[model samples]
Target: MHKSQEKIPFWRVKKLNQMNSEEWESLCDGCGKCCLEKLEDLNTEKISYTNIGCELLDVDKCRCKNYAKRDHYVPDCVRLSSANISSLKWMPSTCAYKLLSEGKNLPNWHPLVSGNTDSVHEAGMSIRGRAIAADDAGDYEDHIVQWPK
Candidate 1:
């Protein structure tokens, strides 16, 4: 079959745990919502997103400055492997990983669907230009936002 006529690939067909590393990594839409610091209500157990991104996250680009060494730089950073995907309740509604975990299809703005890395930013789904670096954050509670939650 021609390259254009080839199948759409298995993101829509395969389960999250069944995907290979490259396929799994490609699922990230670069929304940067996961890079933000989150707050949880001790009483209600509700998770709230913050506009304060991690120190290493490039707020303008919506990407980590040191992705390969992110865990080394920030020990507390939660690694989103297949094993932990189902347990993360704080992921944004637009997150590809979370959507797939919930058995939902990816959105049209996703890079995998749009075939453009900038689609997430263009669709206004990314944290670009909307978040502050954690280094500049004053108080976690003050930075709480409802958009990505």
Candidate 2:
């Protein structure tokens, strides 16, 4: 197809809020770092990532077990939306939503760019096989890791 006739990707053509539900959902790279529990320093407001996966996260698949009902199961779960994306200071640097909202393009490992969902895992960006279930994790402090940042 001619360059003018080629269809641009939705993410390139529309803002986050203008995307449909499916388009918005597809932007997630499925790295699972977002599902990991985090700790915050009250005095300095520093955020620390942990290898402990949320109760609703499927550690192996790196996806939520019940995404539609995650809010119901985890009352404290922070839902990422166009409205709140800017204020989420703790969101991982590799997060697609964060990147796009910051006027950056998606990384090559992003599923949308790679055309393969496993690319994120293959790039060693996903928490698959690395995260422990929340129930099995003894202490959040002990699981603190720097990779997610």
Candidate 3:
């Protein structure tokens, strides 16, 4: 008979500061939805997600075009700091960070769980092959959409 397996202590179980670099990196599902440009209603402070992406985002890859110096190119680029994870309001509802912050379990499609990098894409959660470069998208209004809708 196989012996009982030891449980893996996930980052969600630990506080942000408790996570090491590798654990912190694994938190990302890499859907690239967060990289998309968003509009906030200044009066109500409500945010609307758009299909339009940041100029530095790679449409298919859903990663920063210049990750090393992202802040240099995009002055407002948010560095995913453990210190700010709890307060970052714009993170997607499906994001692992948000899910964990709210004490929810990670979804089955998450790469960390499925051990498949393309699972997000296979689940239709990714921006792959669907995004148009920001520089090429003329009007922000034109890019407005709720993907599942």
Candidate 4:
């Protein structure tokens, strides 16, 4: 009889704060929703996602054009980490960080669970090919969308 190997699920076993740098980084599902511009209502404190992507976002690849220097280019860009996870209320509900922080499991489309990097795009979760570049976008209010929710 052939021996069967047990697979260990890292996310289930490890707390978000316990993850190493690589593991923490890998938790990102590459959905690119975080790269989209958001508008906050001053009165209601509600955040709305816009289809107009950040200047550094590569819409097709759903990756940043300059990952290393993103903060330098976009001073307001919020860096997501375990410590600041709770403050990311504007992040997409489908975002892996938000899910994990809420003690929920990763979606099937997440690369860590799907074992394929393109699974997020295949699941129609990524902003790829759908978002307009911030430079080309006219009005933020006009570009508001409900998909990122």
Candidate 5:
């Protein structure tokens, strides 16, 4: 924790919009939990996270299969914007977007802070092997995963 060992830049000390591209991209913890399909109840407006993930999500790495054309493949796929981060409700509790928007610092396990992208999976913050691709799971109702964590 000494000043000499602190590699995090001052930009990381700023808010989400104040960060440069490198800092911004590093904020994504690569948990892949956000990539999972969520269904919202029309009446209650509550969202339910299914075990189903997008076809592009890599089951092992918990990253996108197609990062560039994801918007084309899934038209509704939200490209995180400065405007949207604060209101994104379904983002995992450990998500960087939710954290920054709430005026909190990134957790120690975050890839950006830890300097290792795989730290997410190591800390069990990533969905990883738990996610089943939507292509494999036909019925969503049957695949609802109520994660106790």
Candidate 6:
């Protein structure tokens, strides 16, 4: 096809705020890193990630068991939206929302690009087997990890 006739993806042509609900939702790569517990040092204010998954996170699937009602279970749960995308500094660097907001392209292993839901896991990006359920995690400090950052 000619360059003029070539079709562009909605993500490439539309800003985050301009996307419809389906288009916006499709950007999530489902890494589950966002569901992991985090800590911020009082002195440096630097954020640290932990292997401890939220109580509602289904570690194996890298998704929340009660995504629709997560706020009821975990009050502090952050719901990412186009308006709040830029302010969520704790969001993983590999997050599609974060990447696109910063004018970057999605990685090859992203499901949207790979056309496979398991691509994130295959690329070792999802928290599938790495995260320990919060109920079983003894201490958040002890579970501190660097990969999610």
- Best-matching candidate per lDDT: 2
Which residues of candidate 5, in runs, are more than 4 Å off?
A: 1-8
- Clashes by residue pair, model 1: none
Ranking by lDDT: 2, 6, 4, 1, 3, 5
lDDT of 4 by residue, 10-102 (tens): 888898999998898899999999999999999999999999889899888889999999999999999988899879788889998899899
RMSD of 2: 1.1
Candidate lDDT values, in order: 0.89, 0.93, 0.82, 0.90, 0.80, 0.92
**What's the CA error at residue 55 for candidate 2, in Å?**
1.0
Q: Model 5, 22-108: lDDT tens per residue?
A: 777877889888888888889999888888887788877788988989999889888997789778877777888787788778888
Tell me the tens digit of each residue's lDDT in model 6 across 46-102: 999999988888888899999888899899999899889999998989999999999
List runs of model 2 lying over 4 Å from the truth. none
Error (Å) of candidate 6 at residue 101 is 0.1
Let me know the TM-score candidate 3 reaches against the reference structure: 0.87
- Pairs that collide in candidate 6 are none
Error of 4 at 15 (Å): 0.8
Candidate 2, residues 1-149, lDDT tens digits: the string is 88999988999999999999999999999999988999999999998899999999999999999999888999999999999998998889999999999999999999999999999999999998789999999967899998987
Model 6 residue 37 lDDT? 91
Candidate 1's C-alpha lDDT?
Answer: 0.89
Across 1-149, the per-residue lDDT of candidate 3 in tens digits comes to 33546565676468767888888888898999888988777999977777888999998888888978988999998888767877988787888877787778889999999999999999988888777788888888777767611
| lDDT score for candidate 4 against the true structure | 0.90
Best by TM-score: 2
Off by more than 4 A, model 4: 1-5
Q: How close is every model to the real structure, measured as TM-score? A: 0.91, 0.95, 0.87, 0.92, 0.88, 0.94
Sort by TM-score, top down from the best: 2, 6, 4, 1, 5, 3
